[model samples]
Every structure is written in C-alpha cells, then in structure tokens.
Target: MLIPQYLFDAEAFLAFRIIEEKFHVISKSRISLLKLQLLHERALHRGHLKVAQQACDELGALASPVTGVDADLKTEVSLRHARTLLAANQFSQKSGNAALGLPYALASILFCQSFNLDLLKASATLTLAELWLSHGPSEAERALALLHGVFPMILGHGGLELCARAHITEAKCHLSDPSYSVHHKPDLVLSPLKEACEQLELLEYHELAAEAFYLMAMVYDKLGNLEEREKAAASFKEHTLALRNPQESVDDILNMI
Candidate 1:
C-alpha cells in the first residue's frame, strides 16, 4: 500500500490507526525502515509513547539480523531505538529502573564510535548524557562533562533543532547541579535556555519551546525577577496552547503575547 507522507503527518489518532492497519503489509518492503522511522518520530513528537514504541519494536526486528545490513543503517536504527527506549522509560516512571535506558544508549554510542559517524556519535553521546542526567545531581557532573564535549559537534555540524536540544540539555544540567542552588547563579542556566527557546521558536517546535519557557519561568522566579517570570510564564502558556491546538494560527499565538 502506498501511503502518503502527509497521512503519517495527520492527526495523531488517525495516523496511528492508518499505520497500524497497514503495518503488516508495509513491513515487508524496503521502504519499511523509512516509514517506521517517520512513524516513530511523529509519534514521539505527538507524545504517543505506545505508538512510538510499536514503531521502535518493528525497527528493532528489522535490524535484528546483523549480518548483511549496512553499518550506517544499523547504527541509525540503534540510535533511534535508544531514543525511543529513553522516551518510553521517562513516560512510564518505572521507579528504581532509572538505568533502563542505559544499555540501548551504550549500544548506540558504541555503534556510532565503531562506524565513525561523528554527527550521530554526538547525538548518541547526548542521549547518554540525558540518561545520566536523570540519575540526579551526582550524575549531573558526568552528564555535564559529556554535554560540554558534544556542544562543539552539535553547534558546528548539527541542525538548528539539534543545537537547540544541546543548549536545553546544558541548561538542565546546570539546573540539576547542586552548586546552582548553593551559588544562586541563574545567569549560567538562563543564557543557554534563552538561546534554546530562540532556536525552538524558530523551528516551531512548540511543545519543546513550551518546556523551555516553563524552565525559564522557574529560573526567573528563583532569581526574584517577577517581570521576566511573568513573560516566561505567558510564553509557556502560549506555546502549550499552540501545541494542543496545532491548527492554531501563528498570528493567534502571537496575539496571546
């Protein structure tokens, strides 16, 4: 069945249903990988963890036979699988299993290293750092070190959205740093967050931008900057509403400001 790309980009429920109905037929073809990847990304973007997981599982199955597949293809699959695993783990709140994502992350990192895929290596590194970040402040040190190492790669070779993600991760690392509270330094966190929001807004990554704005509001509140906090909070609300109502016009969202 030839499915239109826009069908996969349609409303989440409809997309999920269409994909599920055609999955068995589609999985037999060479285009399956691309289709599954697109589904995984769209599902993840729409916060449909189960649908993403379904796509990831099929991707994992396709990549299971390691003998004849192209090295780069395998590595890309590994990275996406790791990302999906991490997202699922985060959404499930499977307590005491914080390291549930560790092996998948390590596999992706190792695949990147072995294949000498530098840009992908940087992404895999970021995923590892994110996993470490979830382990708390003690692990934030390790995560920060990795984030620092990848920033150059992400900024120099990665796309704008990836660069924005790196900035957001860096800000999160700082926020999670115990020293941040002790030193009462909001600027270190705020600067990167501001940059991240700019990039995210430019890309129209509304949900992620909403998250960045929410963080900014918290940071401003901590620093006793009520005016800035109010602005950030307003932006957060605007972006959040935009995310919920994806059909909302840019002018409508801007009018909320």
Candidate 2:
C-alpha cells in the first residue's frame, strides 16, 4: 500500500500483485476494503481507468452488505467513482463526448442529496455544471444557473480547492456565454479567474493555477492591457514550471520574475 512513495510502474505492478495475493487470504472486511481503496487510488493515479473502475466495483460490492460506518463508506465510494468518471470524461480527446459524464454526475448528486451530504452535493453540482459548460454556448445558460447557487454552497461547506474550482467554472460560463462575450466585456471574467488563481496557488495546485493564469492573461490581452497580460503570462509560466519541478524552491521561480 506504500504506492504513493514509489509510483514507478514496476513497483506499482509488484504492489498490486502482492495486494491481490493478500486480498484472497484476508478475512477481515475492513482490511480488504483498505486494500481495494489503495488499488483504486493507485490505478487512477496511473491512468488505469479500467483497473480503477474494477476496484471501485469491488469496493461497492464489499461495502454494500454493511451498515453504520460502512454505509458512509459506500456513499463516499460511490461519489469517488462518479468523480473518477467525470475526470475521465472531462479529459477525453472526444469533444463530442461532453455528455459522457452527465448521468454519473446526476446520479452522484441524487445520492448525496438523499443522504443530506451538502458538501458532496455541492461538489457533485459543480461537476455537473462543468460537464454542462463543456457543451459550449448551447449549455452555458444552464451552467450559469447551476453556478449561481454553487458559489454560496461551496462557501458554506466546501473547502478551498472546491471554491477555487467553482470560481473557475463560473468564469468559464461567463466566458462562453454568447450574451456576455458579444458585449465585448472580457474583463468581466477576470475577477473570478483571479480569485481562482489565488485559491489554487494557496492550495499548491500549480497545474490548475497555471491554467487559471493563462485564462487571465487572455482576458488581459482582450482588454488591451499589455502590462497586466505580460504579468499574468509570467505567472502562468512560473506555475507551469513549478508543476514540472515541484522540488524547486520558491526562489527559483521568483528569480525568473
């Protein structure tokens, strides 16, 4: 289960083999659950979606027959499966498959709502909004409608990372809205994008932060503010490099300024 420390393919494969061997011999349900969780996470990290899905399916089967704390685990696992599918759909090469994650997102939202899991509900809502936004201008209004309540929901129960994503999604909806864009008001997106970038930086999610900065740079360029554009562009580059070399000190990035 010490897979995170040594994520090399060979090590991961060996660990998986060992885990599978132990799983068959293990009698404790909790121990088996932990092993499955580790396999699920490691497979997802390695982009082995089929393996992750199988792990998730096994987790559901293991958790479904239990109650009390295990019931909570079941719900959490369900949500996680939904999230993994959503991520896969979002990153898919087929833009035409934007609806791929919709059913899972909706199901997760319903599952969370039934349990009164407000935080997970909000998170699932955000995921649904993102999926809608991915449909381009045709679904922008629907995305905005969902986003209108998402910020307040995230603020109330969600953590900084979710809040950052909410801000970014809100900004994306505005950017994609024909009514908003046709007015030539690209600056309207800058505020939320800036908030997203700040929150992502604070969370040390440099890859996503870089994307937010790149969007801000584009907005600044649209506003004809070359200086602000350059600044945002520089930040984007710095964050991008930080993601590639995480061990590099802050001073290393600062020196590029």
Candidate 3:
C-alpha cells in the first residue's frame, strides 16, 4: 500500500535527512549522545571506504548504537542506511574491499526486513545474492537462495510500481546469470517478470511496462515457445507504442505485424 505520491514527500524528506546527517554535531558530555554521533558519522563514512572490511566496520558502528536513535529517526534512517550500505557494498565488492560488501549488503537486508519494508527488502536481498554471485558460477549458486525470503514481502505489498520494479530487478538477476542452467533456466525468470509486468500495468508505467513485455518476450524466446514469444512480441510493440502516444491506435501498432 505504498502510494506513489508519498515518493514526492520521501524525496523531500531524504533531502532533509542528508542535511541532518551532514550538519556537524558537536561532541557532548553524555556518553549516549556521543555514541549516536559516532554512529551517524560512521554511517556516512560508508560511502567513503573502498575496502570491504572497512565498510563492515562502518556497518558495525551503525548497528551498535542503532537502538539509541529516536523511534522516528529509526524508521527514516533504516531505509536510508540500508541504501547507503548497498552503495558501499557495490563500490567495495572488488579489490581490497574483500568481504566488505557482504556485511554491508547483509545489514541492508536486515534493516529492511526489520522495518517490514518489503519492496526495499526484496531489492536488498536480491542485491546480496548478486554480490555472492559475482564471484562466479560457484557463488552464483547462492543468488536465488534467499529470494524466497522476499517473495512474501512482495505479495503483501501488492501492486505498487516500486514493488513491480523490485521484482523486475531480482528477475533480471536470474535472467543475466551465467550459471542458472544449460536449459529450462529462462523459465525461472518468467514468473517474476510477469509479476512485474502486471504491477507496471496497474501503475500505468507505460515505458517500463513496454520493457517488461519485451523482457517476457525474450524469456519466451529463450524457452523456444514460438507462439507465446510471438504474442509477447506483439504486446511489447503495443506497450512501446503506448509510450509514444498513450492513445495510439491498434492499427498503427499492427502495421509492423
């Protein structure tokens, strides 16, 4: 039940939070207050680190005093902090960053789940799996391991555009995976892709909806389902033209058929 309009408010709030995170807080007498300041600073430092171990430490810093945060800020920072961890995880996944991405990504996943932010949680879980997968075929085996954890979240959230996008993001992971299977693999992606398409249609996300059908068509092609592929291709064209002009006539889209 995440309303799209709330995003406008969220954007504004995220901006304000950035300012709050950046505005220097003078160290004070209270030990509890000092810990909170340390937590905030370390959370922000997540983006500054290139190594994974350092990022992990940064995550620890945030986690240690997370309880000290006011309830309201807890909700606000939970999502934002998760996003920052993912960012740092991506940046540090290679080189000296070591397993830094693992902790950051894991923390992000936990924070999202703790708050019942299903769409965000799903995205975070998929991202964590992807980080493990990037190590190659052996690691990719774990990519879908935690996907089930997020599925219920997605179902509960229903049909928001963000929910759809989250599903599409994870589905793409399976689609692009090198080790999914020698065959019968693209079939694995169809359900999530279809779910994404349905959600996008509900939200009137014309451009993205078109892309979803195009992705579905590609999956059908991979599965060697000629009839379904053709039908999907037809829908892809329809959605594409819908973006060009929402009221475009079927005859115009049919001309290429």
Candidate 4:
C-alpha cells in the first residue's frame, strides 16, 4: 500500500527545510553527504531538481561508506548519490564541461532501479536515452538496451507513452542535423504516447494530459503535419483551460488556449 500522502508530504517538507538550512553550515564531508542524501530524497518526491547539483557536490565530498547499512538502504543511498552525479554530468554537458554524463547517467539507472522506484527508474532510463542521443550515439545504443528493460516497468506504471514520447522529442532535437539519423517512425512511438494521454484524460488527470498533448504537438510539428499539429494544440489548449477553470466550456477553453 502507498504511504499516507499527508505523512509523506509532512516528512518531505521537514526534510527539505532542514537540508536547506544545513547545506551551508555543515562542512564535514560525512555530515554533508548524509544531509544532501536526505535532501535528494525529498526533492525526488517533489519532482524538482533546481538544487540537485549542490546537493550532489555534498554527496561527492564523502568517502564511500562502509558496507554495514541494510542492503535496501544501501541501494537507496547509492541511487541518490548516482542521481547527484547524473545532475552534475548534465550540468557539465550543458555548460561546456567535458562530455562525461553518460557513465553517471547509466549508473543512476542501475542503482535507482535496485529499489523498484518506478518513477526514478523511468526517469533514469529516459535521461540515459537523451544523453545517448545527444552526447553519445554508441552509448545511445546501450541506453536503448537499458530502455528495453525499463520500458515494461514504465508501462506498468502508465508512463510508457509519456517516457517514449519525451525521448522521441529529445531525439528529434539532436537528430535535426541531417548527418544524424535519429528520427524514428513517430506512429510507432507517438501512438503509445497518445494512448497514454487519452488514458490520463479518462482518469481526470487533466494537468498531466495537458502536458502530454503539448508533447504530442511537438511530435506533430516535427512531422510537418499542420493538421495533426493543430489537433494536438487544440487538445493541449482544452486540457490546460480545463485545469485552470474546470467549469469552463470547451469553447471557452479553446478561446483561452
């Protein structure tokens, strides 16, 4: 069973506040690592990573701990550390640091999945796919292999379409260069994404479905099908409008979008 939301939110918030306050004051490597590890856990729960690198820097300062922690706890700590490394690697790649994010990204995937946290597992896989397509195509093949394994997990959690579509969008960004043959048949990937969005719509996951439709528009735009693009855009508009004012009519939503 899922943990109670209120308790989870309360604990996460307290952890976040404590870590933010301690980040500057704690100088000991071991202490910093412990605090940052907790901070990373909270941030993951909230799906925000604005301070992920700073948290990772703290994690990197410590010597690896001796192997006394429970195996599950050890896995959790390792995965959190790997996520920090992945964040650092991505930042470095973006800021013209040497392209070395793939190893850390791959490690993050391996470790995060050790605990069966589906969101983190899917995220790591998706990030690896993106890193492969952008900074390393040979690595991208390895990432695809990893993705094949993780894809079923993502599907079980109803994230397969969203994850696939996001990867396709990232691939397009890198593949736009004629020299790169990164484009896939959108129908194959995008169909699942669309299905996922429809499912979300049925479940009243309006905000998520809105995001999905926005992504679909990106795919349609890339395919140069203006009609499909328009349709996706309309869906995005409708969903987002509904989210903003659930009582609004479809016509009103369309007008707002």
Candidate 5:
C-alpha cells in the first residue's frame, strides 16, 4: 500500500521538534512527547553517561504507548525514538539481523526524501543512510543507489549546505565499495566529492570544503596521483582556518548524523 508521505513528514517533524518549550503543557490531549536527541548526543560528547542514559530512558517512554488517544503521534514518536536509539550506540542486534528501529527509520527517511522534501529531513535521512551503509557491503550498495536517487530530490529544496552534504555522502558511499578502489579506477567517487567541494566553495562553507578536499586527497592518494593528492591536501589546509566555530560547525552537524 502507498502510505501518505505528507502525514509521515508532519508526524516525524513534530516528533523531531516536540519540545518547543518546557512550560507549554498539553498538546491537544496527547502527551508532550519531547525531542531530546541533542541532549543525549551532547551528554555523551561531554562524558556524561548518566545524562545520556536518562535521555535514552526518556526516549523509551516517548516511544511507549503505541495505542492511545494519539495513535499517529505514538507511531511518529516511536520512529524518532527508535532512530535515536540506533544512533546512540547503546543497543545491539544479532549479526545479519536488522535492528528493530532501523527499518522504521529507513522507511520514514525515504518517505521524507521522496515526498516530504525538507532540509532537516534530508539531512536526517542522509545520516541514517550512512549508518545503514556502514553495516557492510549489501547495505552499502543499496545506500549508494538511494543516495544517488535522493540527491536530485534534495537538490532544489535542501538548501546549499544540505545539497552539498548529500553529494559528499554519495561520494563516501561509493568509496565504500570495491569498484571504487583506485586499482580498478581512479574516478569512481571523485566526481561527486569534487562536486561537493565546488558547491561548498560557492556557498562559502569553508569548513565543509576542508572535509571534502581532505576526502578528495585520500581518493587521489589511493589512485597514486601524488600531484592531485598534494593539491587537494593543500586546499584542505587552506580552508582550515576559514572554518566556522569548532564547537558549532557544518562539519560537526555531519558528525551529529
């Protein structure tokens, strides 16, 4: 059955931003399912395991109550919560078995990319796709295709940064495959990486440019193209100081994914 992407997008969007304010109480009869994704991420980064676990527990509660006055809301919160759990590294599943949250996350992410079309959703989807790819080769091939297909979908709507990021993601996914090895060919992933760098340059997103350039250098190195590798490395260093605040950055956003 063809599910409604609009409804999914709105549901996921609300789940992602459920906590607009601490004082706001009651939301049309449903619980105020808060979004504390950032809190858990930040807590872990700061070595606050307790805080991170608390966030996880909060996610579980938010994800609970599959049947209630707000059924759709429950499903949406559960999906976001599952995505959060998958991202937190606090859960594990057997080999060759997809985690419970992953399939739901992937479905909503695709729905967002195919129909919802928003910058935040695009970024989130790409991040989840990367995670899916990291599971190994089979997932990598699927993710490579998905990233390529979604790139155009996001191009016009995801803003300059997100579009560039999508290209970079496509490039990285390509690099994950054996066909991308320089021994076989020097161009498998270079095109998109270069495109991403160029887009970043146009947008004056220098920090992101640095990362793209660095990855380009690695690809060139693998190709044994010392001159091109040197050039890319130089460019990467040139953009280093131009980066945004290290604490809050374009690169860091990619990491958050």
Candidate 6:
C-alpha cells in the first residue's frame, strides 16, 4: 500500500532487536524459539546470515518439542525454519523437512503479514511456495491453483497490504493456464477477490496490480476470448518481469496449467 521503505526497515530493525533481547533471556524456552525464528527472519532480510543462522539453530532445536506449544507459536517456528532454508537457497531439498507445517505456517504468516509483520510474512510465503515446488511440477501447479482461494482468505484475515498484493500476483502467475479452469461453486461469493485486488491497488501495490491483471487475463481466457486472453498473457509477462528480475519471474508457470 505504498508503504515507505524506511518505515518497513525501521520496524524490522526494531523487531529484530526486541527479538534478540528476548532470546537472550529465554533462550531455552519455546517462546525464545519463536523470537529466534522471527529474529532469524529479520536477519535474513537484512542479509545478515550469521545472525540468521544462529536464530535458525535455536529454532531447529525447538522444532521437535513444539507439540505442546501454542498452535500459533508452533506454526510460526515451522514457517520461520522453512523460510530460513529458502533464504539460504536450500529451499529445494530442505523445504521438505518442514512440509507438514507449510500450510499452517502459510496461514499464520499471512495473518502476521496482514498486521505489518513484513519480514515474517514474506519469508514464510516464499518458503511455502518453494516447498510446494520441491514436490515437483504437479504439486507446484496444485499449490498455485489453490493460491487463488487461499490468498483471498489470508487477505481477509488481516494480512499486510503489500505482502498480500505480492501473493495475489504470485497466484495470478500460477493460474495463468488457459486450460486450467475450475467449475465448482465456492462457499463464499467471489466478491472478496475483487475487493482485495482493489485494496491492494489503492495501496500502490504495483506488483499486485500486475498480478491482478494477469489473473483477470485467466478469467478472460476461460470465457473464450482469444484476443482478451492474449492481452492478459502479455500483461502478466510485462508486470511479472517488472516487479522482479526477468530471471526470477515464473515465466513458464503457465505450463503447469
């Protein structure tokens, strides 16, 4: 939502400090694990690998005994661990270790993200996507398809405006398949989809706008308009590349559909 970069950075830095202080006091507690996970996430974002690794080590130690922990805390730890792997470029193999917690982590991250936990949400979603991709093209495609439904809920649940927009963009990229159409009726009206898109756009979510446009293209394609479909495809390609480097764009993501 056109959030100031400085504001985000400042908030992240503050959170990291608080988390670090909290960890020193309760390093052996489950709550410390939670703080470590978050601190590690912030460290990763700031490209502080040493700190991130230290946080990850603490999180890993706590991962096993998280059963009796609060559901949300457990979810946060799992998500943070997965995210650390993603940041390290080890997402391909390591994400599988956190597979079981992927969905829950994604949900929790979405909630936290909605509330301005930028670093946490970004790390979690990026990892969740990577974990899904590690399962192979079929699973990746499935994850992308489900994103349309899953993301809207996250947005409704109080996800951050920018992160939610990024997610919608990712979802649109995944759903770019001309042949992948769903016919089942959703339990809720599809109005939230439009509403979320609008909110993102109002918030200067350019990346998200690009994604919403791409998703609209998919809908147009499903309606059998060749001209409109081509326009949507082209727009998707344009915006996707603009938001990130072309190499990072999911250029062939539509192939899965």
Instruction: Highest lDDT: give the candidate number.
Output: 1
Q: Candidate 3 — worst ten consecutive residues by lDDT sum?
A: 248-257
lDDT of 1: 0.73
Q: What is the C-alpha lDDT profile of model 2 across 229-254, one tens digit per residue? A: 99999999998786666543333222
lDDT of each residue in 81-135, candidate 3, tens digit only: 4444544544444442324446655665666556766666666665566566545
On a 0 to 1 TM-score scale, where does candidate 5 land against the true structure?
0.51
**Candidate 4: residue 156 Cα off by (Å):** 2.5
lDDT of 5 by residue, 112-219 (tens): 545543544555566567567757766777877667665665786776556776777677777777666656755657877887887777655565578789999998
Give the candidate number with the greatest TM-score: 1
Backbone Cα, N, C clashes tallied per candidate: 0, 0, 3, 0, 0, 5
Residues 82-149, candidate 6, lDDT per residue (tens digit)?
Answer: 55554454323343444554665577575565566655555456456655654555665555654444
lDDT of 5 at 85: 50
TM-score of each: 0.79, 0.70, 0.47, 0.48, 0.51, 0.43
The segments of candidate 2 whose C-alpha lies over 4 angstroms from its true place after superposition are 1-62, 65-74, 182-187, 244-257
Task: Report how far residue 53 has shifted in candidate 2, in Å.
Answer: 5.7
Q: Which ranges of candidate 1 are over 4 A from the true structure?
A: 1-30, 92-98, 181-184, 245-257
TM accuracy, model 4: 0.48
Of 1 and 4, the candidate ahead on TM-score is 1
- The full ranking of all candidates by TM-score, starting with the best, is 1, 2, 5, 4, 3, 6
Decoy 6 TM-score against native: 0.43
lDDT of 4 by residue, 145-238 (tens): 6556666656666443345435443433333434443146666446655776666565454554675677678778878879988998998998
- C-alpha RMSD of each candidate structure in angstroms: 7.7, 8.6, 12.4, 10.5, 9.8, 10.4
